[model samples]
Target: MSEDLSSKLLGPIKLHLRVTWESQDSEIKEYIEEGIAYIDGICGESDYSVSGLPRILLKAYCRRAWSGNTSMFEEDYRRQLLRLQHENGVRRLRRKRNE
Candidate 1:
């Protein structure tokens, strides 16, 4: 898929990003969320996004945590072990110390 970003006055800025074609749709979203959690643990919430999170942060953090050497996330898409990925998911990931 190609997306053309443009301004009324400015012509365009074309950004080409990777696209993943997979059988597991819901699993992938959950996978990204798991990666985000791992990344958050590493980065400690600096300039996080307004919905309060961004997938790219997880990407970059994975770049850092895995020493830029592994694709652990894509290979290891997370699942709700113990019902963790609820609306309480973020809260649960945050409570590591409290636990």
Candidate 2:
């Protein structure tokens, strides 16, 4: 994408990540692309319009790219799993009262 176009598309994630409109840095671009791809994989399809918690996750993943850390990824992945399970109605079982 052109710098102009990419800049226009910058949302909270980009702002928080400090990705610039005139970003000629290859590393930033690569990490941002990786973040987008990661989100796509999680959703099981291609997605460009990102926002809300997913946007936060995308930023976190991109930051991880900069940090080169796996621990953050593991924690974030676990959080995503729990969120998915909750959304799917996989609730914890409640204990029964004794008679």
Best by lDDT: 2
In model 2, the worst 10-residue window by lDDT is: 90-99
CA lDDT, candidate 2, residue 82: 49
Best by TM-score: 2
- Candidate 1 residues lying further than 4 Å off, grouped into runs, are 1-22, 46-55, 60-99
lDDT of each: 0.36, 0.54
Clashing pairs in 2: none
List the candidates' TM-scores in order. Answer: 0.30, 0.53
Over 4 Å off in model 2, which ranges? 1-11, 18-24, 46-50, 70-72, 81-99
What is candidate 2's lDDT per residue for 14-73, written digit by digit as tens? 566675664535566666667666665554332235455555666677678767873568
Residue 6's lDDT within candidate 2 is 32
Residue 2, candidate 2: how far off, in angstroms?
10
lDDT, residue 68, model 1? 42
lDDT for 90 (candidate 2):
26
Supply candidate 2's per-residue lDDT for 53: 51
RMSD of each: 12.6, 9.2
